[model samples]
Target: MNQHVASGGTAEAIAALVSRFGDRALTGLSVRDLHAHDESHHPASRPDIVVFPNSTEEVAEIAAIANRYRVPIVPFGAGSGLEGGAIPVAGGISLDTSRLDRILDIRPDDMIVRVEAGVRRQEMNRQLRDTGLFFPVDPGADASIGGMVSTGASGTNAVRFGVMRENVLGLTVVTADGRIVRTGSLARKSSSGYDLTRLFVGSEGTLGIVTEVILRLHPIPDAVSAIAGFQTLAGAVSAVIDIKRAGLSIGRVELLDEALVAVINRHETLALAPLPTLFFEFHGNPESIATLSDVIAAIVADHGGTPLRWAKNADEARRIWETRRVGLGWAKAERPGAQSWPTDVCVPLSSLADAVLDTHADIRASQIPAYIVGHVGDGNFHCVFMSDPDDAQEQAEVHRLAGRIVVRALAVGGTATGEHGVGLGKRAFQEAEHGAEAVALMRTLKVALDPLNILNPGKILPELADPEHSN
Candidate 1:
């Protein structure tokens, strides 16, 4: 642990940063305020300065300076995370990676792409259009690749293409001492010495800062989507299990409870059935999709689900998915002047039905204006609860309901988080989910990599609150 990196003067450190980055080193309140918080309900905590690092070398230099001066470094991306992963709780230097946005390479032959950490997901996909290759880990918002990799994000496409952890092949990272290190490689598969890539994929920037990424890409599908309505949540859950059991490679299968459907209908102006519905997208040849659709239709029918609705064309398919695209927004806009507290929990396939049904009953009993929506094909679901943040009772009730849901998931051998990382919000449940021994190992890794505790402080692990170790 370097004393200079922990107790250096802020003004003196900023001067050194200015000398290195010149105009790129920013310290005005306006710039600092922009880097304070992420897209979560967590209160804003501004960094003393913000630095826009444009390359891996610059990021390495910034990291080394922070380490030398004992100033904490909080990596900043798109800041669209829901779990407060980007908030600079222990304000020091907010390292903004926006200028590093670049698609370095797209290898259609290998089906992989190399990109800078700050590249936006949508923008990178757009660039890959002509190459017939696309990165598929779409986490709804146009999040930065660095942030997505940091949180191990997965969205609608996760069921088929997999999460960030599966897609990311390697990373160019800046270690705690500002040493530039590369993990993994462009090789499709390797019996590597250590799985360092996986270690940082979901670390939430506590261990190291990712400067670049190499991601697995998928070819454009030949065929597309279908929709089905279910009378009950159990029926939808069962249908998903049946689809998987039948070995159908459905691209995406999402669940939207009646409440969420109603929100979509009201806001998106669609006439979808206000029932527990499953939205699906199937890939492969048209004949294969048609065959799989038949099996799913019969399965849905067996469970008393309504007749499946096939999208007539690409336009219609986009229209059908538009509701799902704006799901969280619609949920938030359902009630005026309400704060949105979105939480996700995942259970094993065998326990998903019971878990979802139980949580639904609990939400109804609690009387919170919350709606259930999830990537149910993979046993992950979310409930977006709308309430007034200023209301202490309402906040307490919301948290209570969220805790209950988490407990139910954990009871079924599930994780505290499925896609969303364990930021400040879920720290209390980490030990409960993964025993103290496992969490202690995680702390050991954090301390070994970031001994000064100067990287994205007060996140993920919660037991590192010693006054002597403070950044």
Candidate 2:
């Protein structure tokens, strides 16, 4: 190890790091500021320096140096996270994985793909197009696989394909002390030791930095598509529960409240019914898909929902999904000079209607400009509040409403976050959600893996970042 770099802080640390990786180690204000925050309401805080490591060896070396110096290391992917997971709150080094983008191997027979952490979801799927296989966890954003795994993200496809926990077969991680560790394997199932792959999946870079990923792939369905429209939010959620309870093989199910539909109308001319609507997809052969669609349509009609609006062609299907894909951006830009405060909570399928209705009431009572959208099939939803960050009073009210949302979900046996990890915003609720002993165990694990609190310090555990407890 370079002792001077290991012992250095700001300037000395930058010099030492630059020497090791040449100009790849950067300390310019613009570069440091760029790695500050994700899509959260948290204020941006710059890191002392940023480094781009192209290979796992470089990442391990950087980790070793950070461990030696007791400096915080924040692993950064595409920075598409909703929480402040990528933010460098302690002003240390931002280790960016963008340069490590690569598809290492594609095993068509095994239905598995090995890739560098920096590979984006869309890029990987594009490459697998001709292979008759595809990676299914699509978290809306073209997020890096590393970042998605870090947050344990799930999107529309999750309703059928499952989340990162199910799709990720294994991982290659660089531990706190710069040691490379491999966990899990390409095998379908393992009765081996601890399930370390899962332990690190939603760790948000708190335990280790993921360098490579082995993902389980699914065969592309012969008939893949969706259709949607509902009369009321409650009705839509009810239909979702009925479908799930009936064991309908729905590929994906998405819910968009009237407010979000209006926002989409303003952004683009889809001319969809400005009402609570659900988007759904069906897989398998044409005969099976038609049957499933008919069954779901009957359920929808039972709830007073309108007839499903089927997408006529692949282009039209893309356009419909595109509207949902860009809903966040459209909402953020709907109100000029305002920032988006995006939040999510998950509830039991049975409690979804109540959770959503109650949360919508809370938002309305708070009188904030907000829109609701979600993957309702699995009881996960998001509320995007538009407000000026400079307006302290408005911001406070928005957060207060968000807290109510989380409380409601927890009451119904749900998590404070579904896909968004507990970066800083949701750390306060982890204890309440998991209880005292569970939270303590989490902290103990953090300390065991990163004694110096050098890996993404000031995250997950409130105590680590608290100056009063940071001695």
Candidate 3:
């Protein structure tokens, strides 16, 4: 079976799917349009049909059908991706996993939880409230667990608990050839054969469809949160570096520029000074929390930062983090009738100040209504650009500025993206960041695992010479 099939097979594939799934498989224009794109600025490209699979067996069946007909299978989660990962660029079947929302088991003794693909983060936490444990990889959005695994996502909590690559211990994956395979184990560490769990974690659904995940959970610790204003972006970032260097187990530290701070204050109805600021959270016992708070406050004062304003209660702390969580929304609200082009990059802790300061200057000079926010504790930050979608010149400028940010990050030995996977936007920078040889090995793995290339085609890897096409 050739991997690349003519468009004619797509109709047959959709018909076969509809026959098996009945009304669950939809061919309506509205449904197709809804699955066309994600939160990305990428242009929408609808799939031929959208199928909702209910179980691991059904997902496997869908993969088999797509493989047999050589139809692309794009997995759909909550549609929260910002890089066009879920878009069916090749126009085949969009496999919606929304029906697979089941929490299989909770092993509080082992500190782990098993969940189906469609389970959202917030819902999972709610279910785990009684377990005295929680899943910590929060990308702001109440993203699906499987989607978070696919993107290898991380957010504020990543500074302490790590990302999906570290937290996910096992996966039940549906291969491109309709086979169900299990990778990793519940046991913490294993010198096993191949770390397939990590490989598929960030493949962006190009390799396989993750049906379920076994995640490592952390205990809910006593926490304290505070906000500090900085005289300059450098001061705020410098304070973060010092905090990390001090070897304190900081739970979360985020940086929001003055512009974004202003937006959040107006949108969230909070009174935070319109200055470059850092939101800090510490987790531990009451004693350790108090010590961490005092030490960090003194450090902030050393860097010309204002006195740390501690959140008085749980509600106050929630409100403080809400400002950081909705940074992109506030950016869009700051400029109505404009599309946001959000991009992020990561650098060494030593190079973070230079990278952020330079990007801030670049955004200012471009005269674009953009703001910067960062998980600076982990050397990662994001810039959201607001531009008119219909204005070609403005779009081009936004693209140019985004490209420059990536280039600067790469120059400083940083990655093009820190959290957002290379769905479509970051594909071009793969070679520059990972070198030709590394990317070639990735292509080899893609071809080996998905010979038919029916799983989420045209993502991650760039348009290199297809070995199958070469004479």
lDDT, candidates in the order shown:
0.87, 0.86, 0.89
lDDT of 2 at 100: 88
Q: Pairs clashing in candidate 1?
A: 5-69, 5-70, 6-70
In the range 1-471, model 3's lDDT, one tens digit per residue, is: 122433348878888898999999999999999999999899899999999999999999998889878889999999999899999888899999899999999999999999999999999999999989999999999899999999989999999999999999999999999999999988877789999999999999999999999999999878888899999999999999998889887899999999888878777666887899999888888788787877888889888799999999999999888867776686786677889888889999899999999989999998779989999999999998988999999999999999999999999899998998999899899999999999889988988998777788888887756544310
Please identify model 1 stretches exceeding 4 Å from their true place: 1-5, 469-471
Residue 348, candidate 2: Cα error in Å is 0.4
Q: Tens-digit lDDT track for model 1 on 260-301? A: 888787776558888999999888898878767778889999
lDDT of prediction 1: 0.87
Error at 367, model 3, angstroms: 2.1
Model 1 worst lDDT window (10 residues) = 1-10
Could you tell me which 10 consecutive residues in candidate 3 have the lowest summed lDDT? 1-10
lDDT accuracy of residue 124 in candidate 3: 97
RMSD per candidate (Å) reads 2.2, 3.1, 2.2
Pairing residues by index, what is the TM-score of model 2? 0.96
Residue 279 shift from truth in candidate 2, angstroms: 1.0
List ranges where model 2 is wrong by over 4 Å.
1-8, 223-226, 464-471
In terms of lDDT, the best-performing candidate is 3
Mind giving the per-residue lDDT tens digits that candidate 2 earns over 115-174?
999999999999999999999999888999999999999999998899999988899999
